[model samples]
Target: MGFTGMEAQKDEDLVTDLTGIHHVGSYARIDNLINFENNSASQLLLVGQRRITIDDVHDSDNGPLRVSISAIETPLFDKKNQMIKAYSNEIVAALREIVKMNPLFKEHMQYYSQRIDIHNPYILADFAASVTTGDGEELQSVLEELDCESRLKKALELLTKEMELSRVQQSIKEQVEEKQRILEFIAVSKLLGKVQGRIICLVGPPGVGKTSIGKSIARSLNREFYRFSVGGLSDVAEIKGHRRTYIGAMPGKVIQCLKTTQSSNPLILIDEIDKLGRGYQGDPASALLELLDPSQNTSFVDHYLDVPVDLSRVLFVCTANVTDTIPGPLLDRMELIRLSGYDGPEKVAIANQYLVPKALEKSGLKEGSEHVPPTLSLTEGSIEDLVKRYCREAGVRNLEQHIEKIFRKVALEVVENLANTSHEDQHNFTISPDKLHKYVGQPRFTSYVYLERMYDKLQPGVVMGLAWTAMGGSSLYIETTTVQTKGGKGSLVTTGQMGSVMEESTKIAHTFARHKLEQVLEPDNAFFEADLHLHVPEGATPKDGPSAGCTMVTALLSLALDK
Candidate 1:
C-alpha cells in the first residue's frame, strides 16, 4: 500500500519533472526511486524530462515505490553564482551593524577618503593609529616618513631642556614693559609732586592720561584688566569680600581680579583710590592695605573663600587725582609717582610719536600715501604755540582731544577729495597750518596772551613770589597798596581768603613794618599808631598756609621802604 501511495505522489511531482528536464534533459520514473511505507530506503530518479524522490521501501511493499517526495528545478548556474545577490545583501547588513557598533569608523572612513585624495599617507596612518591604539606613535611615524623626524625630535628636545626659558623670556619682556610704563607714571607723578603709588598718581586738570596710563600698564604687562571707580565707594566690603555669615557673600575686588587674570601675578590697577569715601561701615583704603602691601600680602584671606590665598605675586597699582585724601598708613606704603602737565617739548614728541599717526589713520588717509603728508608736520614754533595757546593743561589729555577734532575735520575734506578724483590719483592733498583753520575752525587760544603772561607784572610794593601746591609751582604776585586811614591807632586788614596762619602772618608783617619804619625814618615815632591794610589778589580764592609768610613780609617791607 505504501509503495502504491509513493508512486501516486511521484506522478503528481511537477517540480521534479521540471528539475529533471533542466539537469538531465529527460523525464524521471517514481517506482524505481523509493519505497514509501517501509520508510527506511529512499531513492532519487529521473524519468524522461522529470525528477522524483521517495522514502521507506519494504519487501511486502512489492518492490521499491515512491512515498513522500519533493523536487525543484536545477538552476543552469552553480549554487555559488545563484546566491550572489543574497550574499551581497547580507554583507551590506553586516557593514551597517559594524557602523552602528562603532560610530568612529564612519568618521574614520570620511577622513580616509580625504586623506587618500590628498595623497597624505601620514595623515591616513595617524588617523588609523588613533582609531586603533589611540596613541601618538603612529603620528610620529608619519612625521618620520615626511622627512620631519630629525626636526621634530630636535624641537621636542629643546622644548624639554628649556621649558623655563620661554617663561623667563616672557618674564623679562614683561619687566621691561613694566619699567617703561612706570617711568611714564613717574614723570607724571613728579609733576604732581606726591601721589598714591609707585605706579604713579596722574593728578592734574582733567583730560590728562591719568586713567590711560593705568590701561597702558595693563596692556604692557599683557594682563587681564579691570577698572572699578572708587570715586564714591563707601563700603569696605566692595574691596574686601563680606563675611561668609552674610547671605550672598561674594568675593571682593581682589578675588574677582584673581579669577579674571587666572594667574596670581597680574598688574592690577586701583583707579581713583583717593576718591574712596570714609563711611560708617569701614574705610576702603584700610582694606586696600592688605591687597597692596607686599610684606603682608603673601597669605591674603578673603571672607568668601575663607582660605589664605597668595596675593604677594600680584603687582598692585593705584592712581588718584589727589593724594591728601588718601589714608596716611596706606599712603606711606606706596611709592608716590606724580604726573605733571605736559610741557611744550613733550607735547610735540607725543604728537609726532603717537597723536599724528593716530590722527592720520582716523582721518581716512591712505596708509602709504606720499602726497598727503602728516598734518602735524607743523614746525616746532607752531606746536609750541598750540601747546601754550590752544591746549594748556597740566597733561596732554585735552591736547589729544584737540588733535582728534582736527583729524575729524580733515577726514571730511579727504573723503570729498577722494570722491572727486580717481583712486589712483587721489594722493595729492596736504594739510598745513593755513588749511588748519579751515578744517578745525578758528584757533581756540591766542599766542599773544600766553607769551605776555610769562613775564612778571612789576608794580609799586609788589614782589614776585613762588608758591608750591598740588598743581606744581607757580610765580605769584604779592601786592600791597595804602588805603584810607580810619583811626590814629594802627590796625591790620587782610583779604584774599587768608587762612588763620596767613592772617597771623599779616599781623606779624604789620609789626615788622612798623619796627622797620620806626628805626629807619622816624626814630622814637609811633608807626603802629596809624591804620594799615594788607590784601592778596583773587579775593574769591580761599588761599591759606605758611608758604605765603615771606611774601607778606616782603610786601610790607617794600611798602614801608617805599621802593
Candidate 2:
C-alpha cells in the first residue's frame, strides 16, 4: 500500500510539471535563447505563472541543465526543488547514454579520464567550481579532464601563426603573378622579326610606347634593358668609345649598357637615331652603322674595353620620329616597324582596356559605399567620340589623363550623392555619355576640317600632290595662269616661295608647253611669247622639290588648253 501511494504521488508531480511548462519548439531555439542571454545571471518567468532566478550559468559538472524551478505560483518550493533535482539527474543519465553510444565522445571521455589528476585536491576543487551541482557525472568527468586556460592559449597562438603564414603566402603569390604578367607583356615578338643578329628600329611619334616596349621586352626575357639617347650625339667616340691612349678614356654606349644590365644579351634601345648630330666632331650615325650591322657587329671592338666583345647575341632596338635623318648605311641594316599615331578606334580600345580600370582604382572608389556598377562599361561609340573630339594627340597619354579626370569627377559626384542618401537606399551607379560632358571639359576639336577639304576639292587641275618634306608627306595644290603678250620674252614667273628645284621645274614645264603648243598650234603664230605664272597656294609654306614637276606640267597644260 505504501509503494502504490508513493508511485501515485510521483506520477502526479510529473503531470503537474509537464502541464505548467511552456515547451520550446526546437533545440535550435533553445541554443539561440541560451546564446542570446549569454546564460548570465537573469530572471525568467516560467510560463508567466512562476518566477525563476537564474545565476551565472556555465558548463555543468553533472549534466547540461543546472536549476529547474516549480511551474506553480509560489506553490511547494521544497517539493519543486526535489523535482528539479530529479529532472536534472534524468538529463545527466541521458547524457551518459549519448556519450557511451557516440565513438567520438567516448574517445574524448576516455582520454580525459586517463589524463585527469583526480588525486590532487586543488585540481578537484577547480573542477568542482567549474561544474554546476545538478549536471551528470559524464559532464563532470569531461570538465575535470580539461585545462581550459592552457588549451585556449595554445589554440590562439597556433591560429595567430597560421594567419600570419597565410598572409605571407598570399603576398608571395601576388608578387609572382605580377612578375609573370610583366614578363608576358615584354616577351611578345622580337623587334627585328629575326632572332639572329639584326637591328630593329622603332619608328614612332613621342609617347607612343616605344621606350616602354623596349623595357618590357628586356624584362620579359629576364634580361637587361638599356637606353641610350643619340639625339644630339655628335661624337663618334660616344658609340665606338675613346681609345685607352686618350686622357679621359671611357667605354662606348653599348659597353656601358651591357655593364649596367650585367648581361650581353639584353635589349638595347638606341633612341633618337634619326636626330644624331652631324658636326666637325665626327658622324655618330656612321659609327652607329658599324655597331648595328650584323656582319660587322660580331667583333664589336670598344676602345675602352680594348676587346672585341661579341654583340651578336645582344638585341639592338632603335627609336626615331623620322628615319630619313638616320645614316643611309645604318638605316639599310635596320628593319623599321612604323608605330603610327593611334586612330580613333585604337585609342578607344586602349583606353577602355587599360586606362579606365586603372583610373577607377586611382580615384579610390574600389570599395567605397556607393558601388559603381561594373556593368557601366565604356561603349565603342563613347570612346570614339572622346578620341575624335576631346583627345586628338598621336599617343593616348593625354587621353589617359582625361579618363582619370572623368573618373575623379564621377567619384566626387557619387560620394556626394551617397552622402545625401540613407544607407539602406543607396545603390550602384553608372556614368553615361549624357553625364560625360558635365565631368570632362569641352571637346578639343570641333571637326576634322583637313579631311573634309581633301575630299571636297577633288578636281582635274586641283590634283592632290603628295610631297615628302622634313616634317612628313604633305598634300599641296599647284595652280597655273597664262596671259597673252605681244613681247617676245617667253619667260616663267614662279611664285609661292619657290626654291631652286621648283624654279628649274618651272623652266622644264615652260619648255615642254612651248614645244607642245608649237606642235599642236600653228607654227606661224608664235604662242611662246606669253608670260606664264605658276603659283602654289599656301604661300607661307616654303615648297621645293623635283616631285612637283609632273603636277606643274599638268596644271600649265590644263590652263593653256582651258581643259
Q: Which predicted model would earn the best TM-score? A: 1
What TM-score would candidate 1 get against the native? 0.57
How far off is residue 167 in model 1, in Å?
A: 20
Candidate 2 local lDDT, 69-129, one digit each (tens): 3221222223344433443343334335545433344564465458556333233323222
Alpha-carbon runs more than 4 Å astray in model 1: 1-227, 242-249, 366-380, 416-457, 485-488, 524-530
Candidate 1 C-alpha error for residue 184, in Å? 15
Per candidate, the number of residue pairs that clash is 26, 6
CA-lDDT, candidates in order: 0.58, 0.60
Query: lDDT tens string, model 1, 350-371?
Result: 8877777787677665467744
Candidate 2: regions farther than 4 A off = 1-197, 204-222, 235-237, 240-251, 278-283, 295-308, 337-344, 355-382, 385-446, 454-461, 469-472, 482-490, 513-530
lDDT of 2: 0.60
- Reference-based lDDT, residue 457, model 1: 58
